[model samples]
Target: MRSPCCDNRGNNNKGAWSKEEDQKLIDYIRAHGRVCWRSLPKAAGLLRCGKSCRLRWINYLRPDVKRGRFEEDEEDLIIKLHALLGNRWSLIAGRLPGRTDNEVKNYWNSHLRKKLASMGIDPDNHRVIHNARLHRSHSSSNATRSSIDKSTNGLQNNSENGFRDDDDLNLDLTISLPSSQRTGSDHLQNTASRTLLLFP
Candidate 1:
């Protein structure tokens, strides 16, 4: 298999691409078209690695790439898609023509995340912060209501059984029966015994 772009780290340039570099890359791609990323850098006379060339071309130098501020509708679509797709920026960018995945991600980090925060929505989960808190409190209230009902039931049971609040009942119960071995008369006797034990 062919080695990765990072394997040849010694000679490749590491910093920002100059206008000359960009022009060379653009011209090469325009003439030959985008092909094998691994071989494209050497063919284009760029000292940068294939991956860097690919990113520069795709993100910046592409003729079709959109520049300037995102439109209002585009912003709304990004919010909606981000809600549904989370951090899948490529998928979100796919829905917006001429937008790059890196652009969308950077926009989210720099702008949209803060925008959502200002609006009291969690950017990560796209939930209203107030609604999330309300849900938690609502759940806790439900639990509190159920506990109150249980305590009331317990008080009623205590009053009926003539027991104090501190008193405890033997609530442990067990049943053992061999249905195949039990005759009709044996079953009746067992039932009668169980009823007496429970009542007493």
Candidate 2:
């Protein structure tokens, strides 16, 4: 029977990696440098899928991977970062060297989530445990408020398409007629008359 982790190549094992398999993968990666995981199964003689092998390397077997329990500083930093970044664990992980996003996410869900609750904080909102309030805004910025109101009300002049495509509204042009065309009225005007053209 083949394991889910089995690759196209026949040299690999399936399920959890054995000590022998781990050593083989480690040795191959160290010697050739980590590149082209599809070929890794044949190169390292691993029976596991490329994705599984890659994940194992990144999350567990990386040389710089930190071990043991999370420290107080690490916990505090994770909490502070979680408060700012939310569930984007990868970004948060980047800030904390030697910690993977998966590790941080797991630690947050398993440990810090309970800790926050015990401290009367909402893990989701990161807010102090309190009844929700109707947050009414009594903004003093009347200038901005009035401008918004004006814009809303002024829509009457605009088309249903939400565009102020009215030609009259934009026509502020005054044109002067030529002397030849200006001659009119009682007889002939001595001066050229300026005409204001309004589309409306």
Among the numbered candidates, top lDDT falls to 1
Clashes of each: 0, 3
lDDT score of residue 14 within candidate 1: 81
Question: Residue 94 error for model 2, in Å?
Answer: 1.2
- Model 2: residues >4 Å from true position, as ranges? 1-13, 131-200
In the range 1-200, model 1's lDDT, one tens digit per residue, is 87674656588888899999999999999999988888888898989888999999989999978989988667766776665446878766766778899999999999878766655556776554664333223443344333433433353356555656543322222222234334555432332221212111
lDDT of each: 0.66, 0.62
- In model 2, pairs of residues that clash are 12-46, 12-47, 13-47
All candidates: TM-score = 0.63, 0.58
- Write down the lDDT that model 2 would get: 0.62
- Estimate the overall C-alpha local distance difference test score of candidate 1: 0.66
Scanning candidate 2 in windows of ten residues, the lowest lDDT window is: 191-200
> Candidate 1: lDDT of 11?
88
